[model samples]
Target chain A: MGSRLPTGWRDVQVAARAVRLVLTRPAYATAAVVAAWASLTVFVLSGNIAMVRNLVVSGPLSPGDRLVLVREQYPFLGTNYGTLEGVAVLAVAALAGANLALVAYHLREHELSASEGGGSLVGVVLGVVGAGCAACGSALLVGVASLLGVSGLLLRFPFGGLELSALAVLALVVSTYWIAHGLRGGEVGGCPVDVGGRR
Target chain B: MKQTSRSDRERTAGVDDGRPARRGGREPEGGSRSRRRLLLALGGVSTIAVAGCLGNGGGEADGDEDAGSEGGNEDGGGEGADGETLESHPVGVDLAEKPRLGPDPFDAPATLVVLDDPSCPRCAAYHQGTVAELRESHVAAGELSIVYRPYPVVYDWGERAAHALEATVERDPEAFWPLLGYYFDEQSSFTSDTVLERTASWLTAETDLDAAGIVADAREETFADRIETTLEAGSAAGAGGVTPVSYTFVDGVFQSPINGSASTTAIETALQL
Candidate 1:
């Protein structure tokens, strides 16, 4: 195989194959992209909030105090990394936007199978719910506590909200994967109906 | 594995011919149509759901330019003894311009006020990461001005640090930023008393400001009202009990409060809006 190909042809060949794959299975590709963007955003937001909460609630640290106080100590100076960082962030947002566009494209094409469509709906619902819960903080725990009438049960579990948020994110990821996988079979729709049988 | 295209299936299922074809290994035409409709309906719901999430994140960008300027009025009564707005708590330090960089801070149309606790690692990450980068790009370019508020809302040393900031700003405004730089650069030192003492001395020797005087000022109640006022101002601007809350002002108008140590990209997007 090596001898049959030119030295620079392999990379070009691989890229061509990737492009072909995307063109052939656009729905799956779109689903993967959308799922990734949504899940990543949710994960990052939850993780950041969780880290801040852990810092405040855990350890010997006071809940409402700060560490440093002076401004001169800030090392305030301009660095040359802004453009690069900005580009990176812009790229992520653009990719997310593209994901949304792909979802619309798939819908417009009428190419979604029932299972694929169902998976996508479930995934999107899970993603929204998860993101909301993560923002609410200990919502699941609060509900459980209220239902069981045992508020003290939560004392031993610090970062309960974070844990629940992480779990919800996991579910979102799983649901997204399911949608992508379900789309992999075909875009013509899930179960074929035997219309000829009625004749 | 099914070779049939969607249109072909639809044509076979019901192409205006009343007699429904019984395609082998497939459900009846009626079932096919219902399933297609169900899938389409599901797609519509998913589209709306995902769109809602995206819209929630984007809608704030379109808020009226004057929406948040009045946010300070909610708790405006907690003014400092000087009677100036708490948002104007920055003193001593000449914010007019950063020497060789950018235009005058006061003249800048947009202000990005960040309430950060030096002791908060999240705040540190933001400064060292997003804030530092922002200063390089927007702040230096005169596109934006940053007002730093040392909010102590997570550690005991945090309050001390806030006091020190007030003292530095009140006594030696020029030294305020420098001292803050030192605090963040050597944040670990503030954890222990001995380390903090050494850091104080180091600051005294490093900068033109007297370290002992700054420490003494922290212990005094001179800047107490200002500190409290600043805290209230942050809360009024939607600090929401979190340190590292930031509010952006465009054309001297309050735009929105950025909770936590958000990314530079996120802040930049907000600025654009």
Candidate 2:
């Protein structure tokens, strides 16, 4: 039944609410779980992209050929992330984010229906923006780190944290949706009639 | 089925343990908008970033680096001997000085030209066989001059690569050979922003060229026309759409597409050896 939420610290709050909603609203959990599965598949495929290149098409190409492909396939990673390998990390982030959002939504809706107002709507918006900024910042840090060490270190671990954070964001989105749904119902004492639980 | 309502569809979409979660059909307008924007932005950034990383793995540099690891690799004088010489001094990204264009490199002692996609699988094989011969023997003798006009057909990264070649020829330490060697080196990393950035660093460190300028020149603005010309030229030469188009130009006349894919004996027989 939390009403007013704090400002600025949006990202952290979203993360907290997302985990809480995973229990009952299995709908959100299903989305998150599916996304997780997809993300893992992409990660594995990303790892094998190199071998696929060598064995299938573009086999044993020259350095020039290799460079050309990198530039075309991944534009954002080129400008940041320090190396081409960061593309895989980005994929993981997307899948994880979607999964968490679904799980959170289901939970939030359940709480709201049971007469608890749940997370504030403003909180969800702020959380999303904060997560985005953090993702960008993390990518920047990886590139800066390359300046200090042998640039190859970037090849080993690129902006993979984006994937992890994405899951948290997904969770938040799900939770927020459910909470709002519950609030519209009689879940909040003020509604008088059970709008959230009407169905 | 009577068309399911939007909310019902959404309910179905949000399946939990094979059951649709019930909702009051009262989605908050403002919250949904924000959520939508955030998701879109995240998806976009992820695609760009991921494409950049895998594309920059540096597989493209393997070939050229193997050849230009030493100064002897550049021993073949720029003079037109057998017309098969390949040099990297003209292809660096950091062009400290404008690349001196001698006679049309295509018109030199009559080495062959393969204006093909840097990432096509067939192109790699040609590099392995006859390209090796054209580069090592004839070019070393200075009897031939090889000109590489990269036409990126296999992927979008091809365009940036073509520009990078021009950049190397125009500015970097006459290390065109090193950059030229890189053409096939990082094919897998092509078209990815990360690979392009990595190439920027590699070009800077290896050739001591201006990395930033080259990147600026390649990116932000699309220099796709240059690639178009190469493609047009290849098509005009009657190169079948299939890649690894191998054709030699002896003196100034354009010869027919040669079979470089054949074994040495087949090529020797075709050459009437």
Candidate 3:
């Protein structure tokens, strides 16, 4: 506890410490991994549920074949991971995992309310929409914009709406920092307070 | 000893007492100020991002308008009495021999030409949603015909899928729809490396067509020229790299070009149905 540390640096340290503490627990670590996998799956298959349904209902495919298929199709958001857009998707998935893990930690330890995790929830939603498509545009955003007869407007995004994914990344970072600050300051669900300014 | 409630203890200790501190009491001044700053920063970033998107869109729109005006000037002397140049009008393509669904193109009141890439998810969506509805209502009623042009714009797998489609169409025309439907339905399960082999296996198991010969034809690139012709046709229509670009023709005259996933209502309006 460097009392004289700058506020921003202290906030980062606290958040990092809180994340480390939560992930050190096997249960929370598993939850984080599972949540990250689930979030990535949702991001990839959001607009393509029929493909999954077909694979499941159709004739049996070998495990190796299925794995290859997933690998090939995993970059549905764009061409491949070589591009900035594809990297953004991976970033979103990772940040989403960490944010959710922290939220879960707070809920379990501090009895955090659903409303308190609203930021994390919004981050997840934005991640999904932002990771839609780097080339053509976000499928969900396009659908919504099509209703307003402005779907063409999405074409104007400099990175083809990769900015939205960037926004999601920023949002998760902020949420992570906020939760960490709460944990460090003992401001969340009732932790023992040190009135004498003692740690 | 004075009885102290949990809240009293929390107040004395400056610690969270298993209750949300942000809610029922005055939040710490530092935390409150930090939160405000974060929110303001987020809002500022969001504003800038939105502005950038709008700025790009507006700039592109203006550029397109400028190009349109330039084209108009170049063709000023060729304008008809209605001030519309022949090039400005949508031209209908001959679909008499194209792979199609519903009534014969010559007999139907309208024909919708669909250019799609098999690996494109939006094309799949358009096929599943808008095309299905049209097939039930207009195609069933013989009011409309639909011609499918396999345009591979997404991945190498799309070209392979297109080749497979061409083979299927040439070998057993009736099996073409089912094969195309299978490709769209299970798009993610196939890649450039595996599409032809997997398609051959699926066709062998599912259809009566000579799947072995079809696969051989695809491997031999028997229909590469035909696919190239379709690709050129799509490019000539200004489709760019977008998939599921639809062209509607009512009474043998091109009405509109719909980009991306066109809705059933949009197709209906385009056809004046």
Q: List lDDT for all candidates, in order.
A: 0.44, 0.40, 0.58
**Segments in model 1 whose C-alpha atoms lie over 4 Å from true places:** A1-32, A41-199, B1-106, B133-143, B192-198, B220-222, B260-273
Candidate 3, residue B237: the lDDT equals 47
Model 2 lDDT per residue over B1-273, tens place: 012245544553433223335565654433344345445545565555454333322233222332222111111111111222223222211212222223344346554455555544335545555567655665666655555556454445555666776666656525655665575676555555565686688887886678888778777535455555555544333231324433434454332233113233222222222
Better of 2 and 3 by lDDT: 3
Per-residue lDDT tens digits for candidate 1, residues A113-154, read 443334334444444433332332222233233335653554
Q: Which tens-of-lDDT digit does each residue in A1-199 have in candidate 3?
A: 2332224765566567667776777887888888887777666544332222322223234455334434443453223222576678778888888888877665444333333355676677677666545423333344434435675665345455688788888777767766665544444422122223312
DockQ of each: 0.07, 0.05, 0.04
- Worst 10-residue lDDT window for candidate 1 chain B reads B71-80
Cα DockQ of the candidate 3 complex: 0.04
Best to worst by DockQ, what's the order? Answer: 1, 2, 3
The better-scoring model by lDDT among 1 and 3 is 3
Candidate 2 residue lDDT tens string, A59-153: 33356544443332231422212122244344334434443453245344422222122222222222322222122222222322333453244
**Candidate 3 runs further than 4 Å off:** A1-199, B1-94
When sorted by TM-score, best at the front, the candidate numbers are 3, 1, 2
TM-score of candidate 3's A chain against the true A chain: 0.76
RMSD in Å for all candidates = 14.7, 17.3, 15.1
